[model samples]
Target: MEKIKNLQHSSILFGILFLFLFVIGSGYYLLRKNMLQNHKAQREIIVLDIQTKVESLLSALLHSYTLKKEEIQKKHKEVLSFLQKCGCDPLRLNLTPLYQKLNANYTPPRYNIYITDENLTIKNTTFKNDLGFSLRFAKATFDKHAKEHIIGVSTPLLEASTQKFFSYSDSYIPKTDKILQLSYTYEASSQRFQKIQHFLHKMGIVRATSYIILNDGFINKIDFATQTKEKLAQVIEKNQEDAKKILKTLQTKSRSIRQNKDLQTIYFVVDSPILKDAKVLYSITFDESDFYLKLATLKIVFLVITLFGVVGIIFLWYLRKKEIKLSYQEQFLRSAMHEIQTPLSVITLNHEMNTLKTGENEFTKEITNALQILELSYNELSFALLATKQEHKVEKLSLVEIVQKRVSYFKAVAKSMQKKIIVESEDPSCIMISSIELIRIIDNTLSNALKYSDPKSTIKVEIKQSNLCISNKGKKILDTKRIFERYFREDSAKGGFGLGLFIVNEIAKKYDIKIKVNSTDKKTTFCYHFKEAECI
Candidate 1:
């Protein structure tokens, strides 16, 4: 039966441990999986962001290069220099013919030159509506010391009067209080996509190599190595396989391609804004070795922590099994004590009544003394159980009375052990405490004094108004402080659970009582000072 019970307990504990470990493992796996997916998603987002930025930059660069914006700006500067050299008159020049000759091709000319007078009012201009517009409110400065003041298209300004997206360059005419300004229009952008071109330009990625393949066997490649645009035939000859794969993928509408080996490369295809019926393939690459190394390190660290947790669980399981064994033994002892209580009371009552009816004999006296020892042990164990499991009732108990009663109760046991119990009550006083707790305190103290005293020696128990002291002559305690610790026995042959003094200390602390122990070669004394006591 015991083997079966032990096996059952083991099975339950192991089942619980397995369940706990399973939950931890499952949670760890789920967290690791989630972290990997999140990392991958972040990498994808980065590649996509790079693709968009590169595309925007390339588009702007292509537009600027194709339109020869720099050449036109140089021409505008020369024109401004020529106008500055003219120095004709005060508001007399009409620059309409020059403007018409410059803007003959497009309906809305790309560049418009305007001159401002001392009042910054447009005195000579091409656009008729801006004949008298002031440049003072345009946030453009015409610094006389500087040769030119220019604002780039990155943070383009709107014409105050025409609301056109244009950038301007102005030169102050020396000694004339006049400004020669040239303005040019660029592409319009909504608020959302306004800053991409500016950011790319700031990063200086326009000079880097770029490639864009289309469906109609057209490949536009910007090669920074030669600083030239590679034609379709040249690009095909250089990277035929890659070009073919890109073209085929674009045809099949499978635009997203990723390779995650030594080099993590991502190729994305999106519709081109600059070309006709064409898709642009953007490739982004990253070295994934560092990322994988960190992930591996994290796994190793987590495994180490899991190993430690497993060891801790096993250690706790061992402790729990030991506790279970002690619990079973305690349960059996309590059951036996309960069964013995009835018979013990009957035997005690019958023994006393028979002694009263007949004459006293040595056999009856010995039985009586044995019964007293049995009752002492029974009381200790019974109180140990009751103290843990029961709520006690508080009452005013006379310390003197309780001490005298316990000392008298233990007199027979002391007599049987060839020891004498001597109690001195200096002050008869009462204290507010639980009766059972007070009795246990007195019983345990008296019992210990008797148990540890020298044979045929006197055990002295001193009682005062607020204190109790029990002293005995025995093998001196090596460590007085440790004697009150539970399960700490100086001599195993003394036949005790070593709980008596521990119980005494517990009850003393309950009433704010201070315990003092003194041990020497001659005597060992246990003293309890009651901080709360009512004098009679």
Candidate 2:
């Protein structure tokens, strides 16, 4: 039976513990999933932003190049017309004045004029270094176009030239059999172009490597970490396998991603009117090490918190076990008290009958006294058990009458101790209370007075309109504060279990009865205020 009860109690704790774990586990799982999804979305947005900015930059570069080429063509027409006005005579024209007039139209004038013979060899030139240099590719361009003026892009002849390619226009000077050439090289060192390159270098993507492959096969690497040592623009050979693979991937899909270990590479194809039939491939590699680190940190923190929660549940289980054990002990004590009542009543009844039949003796008187004391202790235990579990029958009773009746009952027990209980009442006062509980309260207080008072002391019991007080001349209660605590005894040698006052307090509290204790070196008083009372 005891094992079953214990199991029943444990089952409740187990149920609560299971519920706690399930709630915490589910919460952690949902939170972790959400965090991972949000992190992936944030990374995608950042990558897309980089792709957009790179496209915008490529458009700007194409526009600048087109503008520079158009300016060079316009200068070619102006120079050709100037030669015609001089009557096709190179000696008759002042080159200095013509150069000044053309240079005034542009910032940092970077134009030069050259005259080439029928053999494609430079005859006269504004730049001194190229005076006799042969134009290897100019003749093919001039014959294919078959026009008076031809504009085309040419690779740099001088290895030390800062520009990879330059724009030049060739015009035939009348009757001279000489081609006038005007060339323009857009310098990469120009302030405006340099600032754009610097902005692209510091594009602000962390742990990412990005590059753009232009139509001209030039790769503009935007990796900021090693950008200082590498050129922003460099031509990639057609045979380079890496560039070929990137171009192949971009052709297959407008956008595609390939993941390797912790890095994911994205290939995006940029479409613009500037590149026309040619495609620009923008590729970026993203490192996900930081994302993994944040997820790992989240897991560790959740584990620590879960560990603490489990410990707290275990602690609660321990406390619950102790409470169950204490409750069982109390149940056992109440059962034992019920068993003692029947036999105790029979013994008291038989003794009274024997004393009535035969004359009383000192031995019988002593037995009677002992039985009364036993009965008093038994009544206290009975009241404690019944008052807590069952509702009592209530009635409007006279407080003065109840006090007088209890005093009379304990008068014989008091005489054996050489003490007496006296009742004092000014008028009849009535209160609505349980009869059994009221008798128990009056009986226990009188019994305690008889037991603890001086042998010859008079215990004064007074009843006013709405109050009852019992004052006895005896040793002062040293710990009056705890006098009404169950099982608390100031002096265990007094021969009572100390439950008398505790029971009184419990019953008083049930009906809103207020109790007060006043103790001194000479006397002690227990007073109860019956606030819900009427006087006649």
Candidate 3:
């Protein structure tokens, strides 16, 4: 039985430990998972923010490049109209001063003009310069979109000499069938670029590279909007492997944002197609050091809190384990004491019978009462261990007989210790209580009075109609109020579990018996005053 009880207690502790571990582990996992999920959302927002800014800027740049077509065609029509009004043909026109006067009227129009004949050969015109050179290179561009009686623009063109990029347009006249084109060179440091730069600044992608790629494989960089003056292509070329991938990916059909990965850094590139075969590929290097630092700090804080919670649970488990052990040990003691009490009663009864039959000296009345008191102590211990009290059965038991029986029981021991016990009753009466419980109550009080009373000093047991009391002249009780408390002792020098008066008080209460203790410097008295029992 003891082994089974121990195993059960052990099982309970193990179960409690496992439950604590499982809860802590699950809480930690969920906390970290939630933090990571939030971090993921933040990262996506950062990426989306970068991509949206680049897309919007590219759209504006494409519009600017394409819109120049209309402006160029408009300027060219003015020249052609002036030529017809003066009755001049493209092959024979010599109006340098008129062209100069027309150009002078424009203010801050950072562009150039050109004139070409049917085969795109430079015709007789005013103010010739190498600025209109890429027009000859883009002859096929005009030829493909050339229409009679129509004016239109060309795809972007690159001047290899100066790295200047521009777009041109052509107008066809039915009167002379002369095909004339105008070239509008791009200003890299234009106010339009400033607008794009301000927009990039708003988007938080400050360190970025932007460029326009031409159909001829030459790059026209957007330098004015970048943080540094270094060319976009040159910076990308520093990482040869990523540069190849970046340039190659820009040519694919998927003109979406792409990644360029190197040993130490990552770049995001998006290419937006502008003209027939040209595109603007924009790339920005991703900076995630701040993001990582914040995430690491969050994890560390959660771990610290989680560590404290786990330690708290372990500490609680330790306290709970102690409580369970105390409970189990108390249960075993109760069971052991209860088993011993049953045989003790049998031995006590048999010894009493033998003494009456043969007047035998094997066990005297003193030894019998001692064993009986020991058995009563076991019963009290059993009740205390169970965290319960003995509910005494009340019946009319004569106090005169109880006192005489207890006095006779203690008489031999009193003589051996040279102490005399006197039972004086003004009125012998009946106490309503269980006979067994009454015996324990009388025995515990009598035992204490005998043990502590000065040897040869008479201890007095008195009985009355309403009460019984035992008075002893011995060591005074330091705390009269605490004598009836369980396991309480004024002097530990006296050997006992200190349960004697406590049990006496318990039985007294069950029978509606009020216990009172009065102590002086050298005299102490314990009295039990019973109420009248309910009559049948």
Candidate 4:
């Protein structure tokens, strides 16, 4: 029996698809995790870079301020020394005319200089208005600190928006009982830094790009809103919260990823190491959507490539499995076909020898039975070898004769089983069919009759009206409709390939013979009805 449990193509397809999806899904999940981790690393790099920028900006601003203070001190010393050498007292001399002399004294036409008495009273002025800022801040700062440095003041108050940072350094003159003040503003550098809008666009800096640099003790400074590489600046008011928070909480630099669930945002706060000798917090807030957008295209391409490659690999593997399975089945069938030949030849030769010597005895019948069974096995092997591509050779033959030959062929089998075939044929029952095909039909019908019939029962084989009918008194076919289908068997215990009946039907159809089946509780009959037949 050919127990070919062949895997169906559809089943292979479904399995491959399932495997493909599982593999791709797992791969996709891993890739996404990797991409997310890489994104975090990239964000850290950007944060560190921004922090470095802020630190450098701070250093440059401190240096610029220190330079401005030193320049003011240098200029003030020069003016005061010249005034003392000329026997000039800034308070006693009509110093209002000294403004032009002072202007001419400096090559770059120095900052507005003024002389004021130590009692915080303005005595001389660059412009009479002087905004009173120079006197107020200079005196308040001078009296407040035991140690004196540049009185860097914005105005009478920190928010006083002259948009200028004033650096005031005063020199006391013993001959004058007055102090000379030199002041300058960073308005030029601030304006130039604010013009970095184009450069900011190039760097992909968005509205969220903001930072604060604390000046430690000073309330007046420039903000990054007008920041440049030349100067790091920040407004005191803008930094008040962070500055106060740091002073109160002293939060350290954090490297962990922080998330805001409500806002669906992530960020990092880098506390730069006391930049320019001042503690500062430089945090960069980024909307996650931008980074997602950046990864979206890459992710799409990756998925497409991965899916395509995975499907290709799975399909190839499926094909390989199918090919290997078929290869093994074919190899086994060939090996079986080859392996059975020696026994088959021995049985056939023994049957022939025994038939010649004993002339129709029971032992000779048994040998013939073995030979007949061997013949069927050989034919089945041939059929498997052919894979159903047998050469056709049509001939005119008497239908009754072919039926007799097949009945005689199965006679040993029938006798061993204690069953008999009763043949009734009319004269000249000739048909045009491949002789091999006709033998196949007759042998299959007779074999089924002997296999399924009750022992000692009669099988009636009749060829009348150019039609053959084989009827057996045996177990009735439960499903006559499917009895002739390949691999279908009414009784699996009666071992055969189950190919016989199906071959009968197919050959009958090919030769334009109509086949039918009729089954009852008592009898089952298979008919091969010839059409368009001619007989003499």
Candidate 5:
């Protein structure tokens, strides 16, 4: 009977083990399949989103350019009307008054305005010396197309004679159908397209290409890529064949001539055909890296989800066994806390005893200062724990007074470090803020200023209406953009958890205050602009 019982027990254990292995294998297979499906779906969505965003961006740009062209045309018509009143004599037209009026009325700066005859000969121009010259040579290509079109603008081009870059062109058609071209030139290295380019760059496009097609089969290409002009030209030429293929595919898919294409080079081609009798195609191309970046981002999300699922299973198993280990964890935490407290208490007591015995000796004072710094650090840690673990109360108090008090508290430390704290104020009134938060923000700033300031130098504090500005002479920040980020520190030698500015930023944001920093090689200033509250 005993032998029979042992055999049954062994058979039961083997069956349970086999069931576990089978379940695990099945779960792994299902998880892998689900992950692959999710990744594919995510990639498709990303590609579609990128396509939509690029289309929208191109539409906006084209619309803006079109509007600008319209405005320029309207102004040109006004100028032509004024010229007609002056009797069609180019030399006697006297465009000075009209030029002044346009300069005052125009939204953007104007470069020059020119009037041309039926033969496209320059009759009169805003630039006096260029009058009666053949502008046809310089603007002939663009003028030939502009004569038929009512309104159009040219892309950025470098003028050979002046060696300057021009960004705009506007044409007017009078009753006689003569054309007048108004041009605008901007500084080459200015921030003209910075915002637009930055937006595109953030979307992960390495380059952008735009084409303005005239009714006469003339194309004006605008390359916004960082690549050199020659390299970009080569790239465009190489991709033209691909563009034609894509155009065919788009026409087939949408059943419309105006459609976009997705190519193998991760580039998107969008074509917009004007509805007018003289149809022109506006084509734009954008890099496809954004689509892939979004896919990679989704993949990372899937990985995180998989990790969490695994952790959840392990966590559940741990919880099931937690009751058995509860006493052990509690004993360990108790012992750890005791061990830490014992050494801290010993250090505190020893410092106190030394200070009392020596009464004002350098060694005693130094030890006392060190102990105070340690105690302050422990207080900060305790405050952080309390803040995170429990609800905090918001109490309205004067920000200026709280700052003063925090500065007073740090006076001794500043003195020990041989640094002076100076406060300058343009406002004597109080500003409302949370007392604890105000103290934390100002304390951190003051501490950092004192720590980094030259040994004998003074840290200046200025208070204007709704603004608190602090300045200190220290090493310039390497990356000023990331100064308020968590765990960001300029100097490795500076002893800090690097949480001070980040905490200050959080508190400032909570209070709806604005913080700005201005730094140079000589000095750095941190300014906090507080929101104005009702006077008490």
Candidate 6:
């Protein structure tokens, strides 16, 4: 009877252990499966969202191009009709009104308008001195072919006589069939691109990003909102090769998306064949890191939760068998504190050096700037530690003076980039706040402006009666909602610790200052309100 009881107890314990293993294994498998499904769904949504945005932006661009093309075609037709009705020969017809209209209202990327006779001789032109000149090479070919067909567009090619590349769109008179060719040259260099660059920056797109409108081996026009020499060369080379492949691909495929070999980026290409025998290719690239960062954050949260769950289960199992350990947490805190102190010490040393009686030279300037950057980095880490420790101090002080001091310090850095700092204040009095806390707020805002603003653009610093504003002309701040969170950067290529704005918010809260951000495709503004405390 004793042997049988012992056997039964051992069997019961084995059964319970087996059940526990099965339950844990099943739970883990299900959780992993669900997480994978969620990841897949999120990827699909991202692709779809990006596609939609590209399509909308492309539509707007094409619509604007089409409107200009149509207007030119309409005016060309009107001129032809008027000449025919007046019975004036092409060579003899006065085109001053037409030239005036073209010059006043229409400024296409390249090539000016010209009216020629049936014999392929230029009769009149919008160009001041080109009137009465004979058509040559591509222009002559365009005239000859246009006379035969009466209505069509020319292929992209350079004109020998004029030494210019042109695209001609022609219209035929119904009964007479007299052809009128409206020539547009491909200059590629125009102020329109500069405007587009500014627009992209305002939209919060990275400055290093670029766009090109290309056909075949010939690049009609290219736009670079922000470009370094290396980046420009890379883009030119890549596009030269990619344009050929893309053109060929368009011939076979409707729409295609692919990742570059580096797998760090993605490109979406869309081709639309338009009315004038022209193909418009729209290509956009999105940084893979942006999407990956979001995924990483989610994964981190999942891992943390999993770790907690595992610890809870282990603790339940060993409650009567094991004692708790507190040394690990203490060690982590100590290590973190040590890391924080090192930077602080460097900042203090640098600050002392900067204030010393040193000569004002390039080296001194560079060192001072570096020291300021180091200080900002140190402050960010310090603030993070303080938050984790749940220690916050609030004080009241003059907000205007804080902003002014930051602007003064940042002016030197901005000047190095050939950028100017402009300040406008409604009140020149004191604000209620702690100096350190206020410095934290201003430092983050100004540092962001200096780091991201266009190299030679002006950063506007405005202080109204109750609000403090800082505006910069650069890439608009992307994901403004999460920009204040730790480890968030609009462009990963711009290396930063990403805790600046996060600390800014912490300091703002400690001082009871309300912060607001507004951005568009041309400018980004961050405003701080001090309504609670009146200006002294």
lDDT of each: 0.67, 0.69, 0.63, 0.62, 0.60, 0.59
Q: Write one digit per residue (lDDT tens) for candidate 4, span 1-536.
A: 34556665656666676677677678777877888898768766765665565455445555566666656666667767777777865645565455566466565444666777656566676746652434555554554431454433322111124433355566556544466666655554444344433433343443223233445464333333323322112222232344344444434534323344211212234444534434444333334556677568767876787778677767767776676666576667677778888777876777687778868877776766767876885785566457366687777788877788788877768877788878898765678888877887887778888888888999999888778889999887888878877567779999876678777777776778888899998998888888635765
Which parts of model 6 have CA positions greater than 4 angstroms off? 1-358, 388-393, 429-431, 509-512
> Which of candidates 1 and 4 reaches a greater lDDT?
1
For model 3, the local distance difference test gives 0.63
In candidate 5, what are the lDDT values of residues 1-536, reduced to their tens digit? 11122223334444554555456557656766676687547545644554454345444545545556666667667776676676666544667777787788555545577777766676777876666766555456555556576555664453445534454454644465355777655443224344445654564434544444445554544444543457544654565443345445556443222212322233343444331322222233344444546656766765665665566556555653553244344344345445666778898887777767867688776766676666555544444434455555665566566667777777778778888888777655556665667777787788778877777888998887678889999878677668787556778697865667877887787778888888887898889988776557
User: Model 2, 141-164: lDDT tens per residue?
Assistant: 665544634555342221233422
TM-score of each model, in listed order? 0.57, 0.57, 0.46, 0.45, 0.37, 0.36
Q: How good is model 1 by TM-score? A: 0.57
What lDDT tens digits, residue by residue, belong to model 6 across residues 1-536?
11121223334444565566566567656766786688557545654554444344334445544545655556567667676787766655666766666556446534356666655556666665666665544455445655685445543344444434455676544454244667655444123334454544453333222123444333443223343457544643464335556657667665555554322223334443332333445443333445556656766765666666566556555642221222233334446657767776776676567758664678777767776676676665666656656544555666667778888888877777788999998756556665766777788888888788887899898987768889998887778889987567778887776778888887777667788899888999999886446543
Best model number under lDDT: 2
Task: lDDT winner between 4 and 5, please give it.
Answer: 4
Q: After superposition, how far is residue 69 of candidate 5 from its true place, in Å?
A: 81
Q: What is the TM-score of candidate 6?
A: 0.36
**Candidate 1 Cα misplacement greater than 4 A, ranges:** 1-28, 56-319, 389-391, 476-490, 520-522
Candidate 1 per-residue C-alpha lDDT over 185-295 given as tens digits, one digit per residue, 9 for 90 to 100 = 654322213354344334322222235655655465532221133542343233323645755666766445444343344445677777667766654444455667877
In model 4, which residue pairs have backbone atoms overlapping below 3 Å? 222-233, 222-234, 223-233, 223-234
Better of 2 and 3 by lDDT: 2
Q: TM-score of predicted model 2?
A: 0.57
* Superposed model 5: Cα runs more than 4 Å off: 1-346, 349-358, 383-386
Q: Model 3, stretches more than 4 Å misplaced? A: 6-14, 68-267, 272-346, 357-365, 381-536
- The residue-by-residue lDDT of candidate 3 on 406-502, one tens digit each, is 7897787677668889988876566577787788788788888887787788888888776888999998888887888766778888777677888
